[model samples]
Target: MVSISRRTFVTATVAALAAPARGARAQEGSPRAGGRLSFVIQPEPTTLVCFNTTEGPAIQASTKVVEGLLTYDFELNPKPQLATAWSVSEDGLQYRFELRRNVKWHDGQPFRAADVVYSIGLLKSAHPRGRTTFANLLEAGAVDEHTVVLKLSKPAPYLLYALAAGESPIVPRHIYDGKGDPLQNPNNRAPIGTGPFVFKEWVLGNYVGYVRNPNYWDSPKPYLDALLVRVIPDGAARAVAFETGELDLGGSTPVSPLDLERFRSLPHLGQETRGYEYSPTLYGLEFNLDHPILKSPQVRKAIAHAVDPAVVLNVAWYGLGERTVSIVSPTLKRFYNAKVPTYSYDPKAAAKLLDEAGFPLRGRWRFALTHDFQPFGENFKRSGEALKSALAAVGIDVTVRGQDFPSYLKRVYTDRDYDFTFHPFTNMFDPTVGLQRFFTSDNYRKGVAFTNASHYSNPEVDQLFAQIAVESDATRRRALIDRFQEVVADELPVLPLMLSKPVTVYNRRVVGHTIDSAGVQGNFAEVWLRG
Candidate 1:
């Protein structure tokens, strides 16, 4: 990883001094259970269950109280959770799971094969990413009381990584059975599950509290007596809390970038970047293809050339991230294509392209458009200002605007009120599950928060994703991904900005938090304090 100082960005490899080895406790002493753990989640989660939403906070909160069929190690190999053992047929069409016995829900009901069957069915139809994640699923049937079989129409190579608790949580069949619109069900707000923690109370706009489940399937685990998630929206306040040692743990870079080095230097604090491999982030400029002016590829490509990613890295982001050329994250070395077309920073060429595209300078400006930045953090707002400044130099007048999270969602996805916006998306464990949703035609569902916000569609891109999804051969799949990147880069539906390296900050007193690939998003079934 690269280290950045306030004065300059230096290319250096530095091991996280505060972090412990992966899959191990922080200190050498045995863990002691009984203290309460307090953490922070920004912008308050809309629901406690993340089956229908992919908000990072909701996923982190839900996974503690909900479980999935399988877990994964640091190498991403499947590990035991609800499903103890599993096997796939030679044809790659059938998967059989051996359920862990003696596991009971928090409400005292025995977990059975029906829950897996029901949950997958809902996921394929309801979950935003699951629609594509489980598209090949032909049937989810129960072989017996403790066995379940999933038959697929074609191979899904990335299916294993998609079963982690955060992405695809298993819900109780009884409580949601025959319920009208699972999205609107009350269970989402107050979830009932078979995880290590139990939902206790949610004092709206303040905090959500949970008590350790005494009957948790994994006994003698979840050593903490209780878990408290405080809703601290401001980045400065979060940094202050960390300085005071009032917060125990927080993930996804909870504090501002300016405060990162301060926390890293503190003796009582530690920061880790290991656990987010399963969910790498991509920040980009999304263009509304339906708009009259942006529909031209020349204009989109010109805008891409006008902005400088170096300034984006050093000035706007404070060198917190790395620039990316393709929609797929560079962290995924196997499929990332470094040879794809790149748009370098060139203002003269941008003006020439606009002039050739028939939009000559009208007085002092070519055209004017409104811009919206993602309201999740302060960096994106600075990025908006940077974009406005950059475009103004190319004779394009830009009006930067800001809104709350809810209003931003409604205006962009549902109302289509803006021309272009700064957006961030999780490319997840694979390109098929994460990258496919942004360009495919079928995923352009109106009112959906994260799927195909740009309304960009191409039949060839869709075909490439379909082929990549079912292609079992590694060599052939890589070829298809390369072609997909070439087309998407040429079309320029969404300008690839930079790939983010998110950090998880925690007190040295915390242990067993970053033991898995999911990191803090894991169920925390075995997490405990060092005391």
Candidate 2:
């Protein structure tokens, strides 16, 4: 019984059979190299700074040591890394690129075009979804030392899907120029990348090594000579270190749906839930609208009709997931909005919207609230104790808490402190890269690590996310992203639960690992080691 098969990222003929039309991975024999792979990364990346954190384990531990001027090619399209080519203009407001010659930067310097115009002006002035993913940059220099250009103020057809998103990595303008606060750069914990592994050591909470760059600009591809990673924040100690072979990879959610049927009866295990089919990602419960009882939209629609997303997808994702009431993930079929408003599983219509939002029920608790829990899986502490037993069967008490992963990104993005949080919002492939900066009020700034952690302002969701970011008429940007998901599903700020898929397991003597859908930027440069 070894079938497995569940990889999806549909269309483009199933992402050209999901990997291998240009990021090579056909594999059968020949292509031997040295070995040392390892891999685990579960909650232990406070900084190995992949452009100062949106933390998917610090951008999957800096996508094999950073380098991006276009990457995604498991049919999330746009390829050329470190810009081997690019072009745009016809009023898409200019672009250019063409860099990659003699590349270097794993401290061997070189890699210019002024380091891709200083990594797009440090991802549009310090990244946290970098000012809405470089919001129509008006300038970006160096059209020489191997070319680069930019100049946009308007038309940004998803800007090369946000520069093939591993969130624009190309750093090193002489180690972040006089680095005072390139997010407190000490080369963001020893990073100097051109990618194919080089930043060699990160012991905080145990392992994070890397080695083989041997001048890695695709020369003899990264056939692994070292890469440890291993942070294993207990999901049954990362499935007993991937069933005792001591892990040769686990990356995404690392087995914990009751240890995935005992690692599918491990015969030297190797399971994969297809490289995130272009990152759908939703999983839910956000709230924190400066929490004085989650600032009433009738108490966040009475906690989205008091939690049930099919019992949070069959008791915290054992039924593995899909419910989703719009944070846009119907496998992103062109801006998914499949008729928004569905908070159905009425706990007496959530006790009549918390007794018409004035919240009655005095002693039996009308509100307690706390939540937190996102230490990246144990299904976010069993969906925060199944959303505190479905908001304590509608009288609401909660209190959950958990933390770790830099104190849950410092209490939901630098101290907005939370009153509710379960996490997972990932790069939803568009609606201006994941639901318009979580409902922009200029992405709610307090210490800005932005994703608008529900400070959720709404002058009509900030004027329909500024006309869904320059709406280039794809039927009026799908009617302004279906009217910004019908005004954030009628203002529940954030609740649209379940829609995950992320799983990755590996260890059949590992070879060519390429799981796209960009969860942790999976492309270990043609992963190797099969002997």
- Highest TM-score: give the candidate number: 1
Please tell me which predicted candidate would have the highest lDDT against the true structure: 1
Q: Which ten residues in a row have the lowest lDDT in candidate 1?
A: 10-19
What is the lDDT for 248 in model 2? Answer: 76
Q: What TM-scores do the predictions have?
A: 0.89, 0.36
Name every residue pair that clashes in candidate 1. none
Local accuracy of candidate 1 as per-residue lDDT tens digits, 166-224: 98999999989898889999989888999999999999988999999999877788789
For each candidate in the order shown, give its overall lDDT on alpha carbons: 0.85, 0.75
lDDT of 1: 0.85
Supply candidate 1's per-residue lDDT for 98: 78
After TM-score superposition, the amount by which residue 452's alpha carbon in candidate 2 deviates from its true location, in angstroms, is: 15
Residues 1-531 of candidate 2: C-alpha lDDT, one tens digit per residue: 111111421112222223343334443565678889888877788777577566677778887887777666445666566776666655567767777789888778788898788888888877766777677888998968988888888976676677753677777888878767788878788888888888777889889898899888887978888888888766787788788888877756676777877788889887776667665678777788887778888887878877778887888788776787888887777677878777777888888888887888888889788888866557678888988998888889988888677777777878777787877776456777676766788767566444778888878878877877876666888888888887788887888788887677888888767545564465486778888
